[model samples]
Target: MTLIVGHRGARGEAPENTLASFAKALAAGVTRVELDLHLSADRQLMVIHDPTLKRTTGVRGKVAQHSAEDLQRIDARLGLPGWPEPCPIPTLEQVFGTFPDIEHYQLEVKSGSTAQSRIVLAAILQLVERFGLQNRVVVTSSSRTLLRTARDTAYPLATGLVEEYGLLDPLKSARRYQCRFLILKWTLCRPTLIQQAQAQGLHVSVWTVNEIEQMQRLIDMGVDSIITDYPHLAMRVLA
Candidate 1:
């Protein structure tokens, strides 16, 4: 069966990367979820998409500038006016704590430098180990440095190469990094590429797929998972 991974924990339904968003995804019967990670000023792993807080939190500073405590208290519901509740940014630990039984987690690390990537990866691995979720998590990143760092870890951490554009040789990069998954931008998903990735023992997962027709097409192409903003809609369509 093709798994449905909630994109930023059902981003279409609730504020992205917030606890409320994750809860909404779970409520829609999604077992797999995808969220982004960035290090705060205190070097804590925070669940948020952008390096800057202006998009989600309406703040002027970068995510790395704020402490995890301060980030968690800020309202993340900027574009989603329907959601009256204050959706605070969550720490990765808090997410794991709240949804311990989630089948899988795709944690996308947002790091610009190799040093920062190493620090983030170490923190993530430590948390995964503490939760006994080493088998349940796949550390994903667009940065080759980050993926390489994850691949080199002593822990058997599964890593995924996230390709937003087909700019790089994705298959070669994925193979080079020994990634188990190739997460492609939905537009980059094609039958031959998908098949090639699968033949190389890589699971193909596409991101931000919201339309039912497109979802069905990808499912027909035999994708391992569809990372969608509406898990509920995907569930119904897939069912």
Candidate 2:
């Protein structure tokens, strides 16, 4: 069966990357979730998609400019109307603690440079190890440097390559990085590519797929998983 991974924790249903969003995904019977990570001013692993706060938090600063404690206090319910409650930005540690039994976690590291990517990946791996989730987590990133760092790390955590534009040679890069998954943008998924990736022992996971027809197409194409904003809808369609 094709697995359904909630994108940024049921983003269409709740505030993206917030604890409430994750809970919503869980309630929708999603066992896998995909979330983004950024390093805070205090160098903590924070669960958020954008490097800036304007879109999600309606604030006028970069995520790295604020400490984790401060970031958590800011409400992240900017885009979604009638949310009815404040949804604080969560830490990677908090997510792991709250959803310990989740079948899989696709932790996408959003970094600007190789140096910062390494720093964030190190912190993420340390937390994964601390929580004994090395086997359950796949550290994914669009940054080649970050993926390279993950490949070189001695930690047993799995790594994945997130290809947004198909600019790079996806297969070659994934093979070079020894990634366990090739997370492609929904627009870039094709049956041949999916077959090739699967043949090479890389699980193909498509991202940001929200439409039912598109979801069915990817599922029929034999993709391992689809990352969607509406897990509830996906669940109903799958059922």
Candidate 2 TM-score, C-alpha based: 0.97
* lDDT of candidate 1 over 80-108, digit per residue (tens): 77788898989999999999768899999
Task: Give the top-scoring candidate (lDDT).
Answer: 1
lDDT of 2 by residue, 18-125 (tens): 998999999999989999999899999999899899998889999899999999899999868789999888899999999876889999986566678778877988
Candidate 1 local accuracy as lDDT?
A: 0.90
lDDT scores of the candidates, listed in order = 0.90, 0.89
Hey, what RMSD does candidate 1 come out at?
Answer: 1.1
lDDT of 2 at 185: 96
Clash count for candidate 1 is 0
RMSD of each: 1.1, 1.1
What would the TM-scores of all predictions be?
0.97, 0.97
- lDDT at 214, model 1: 96
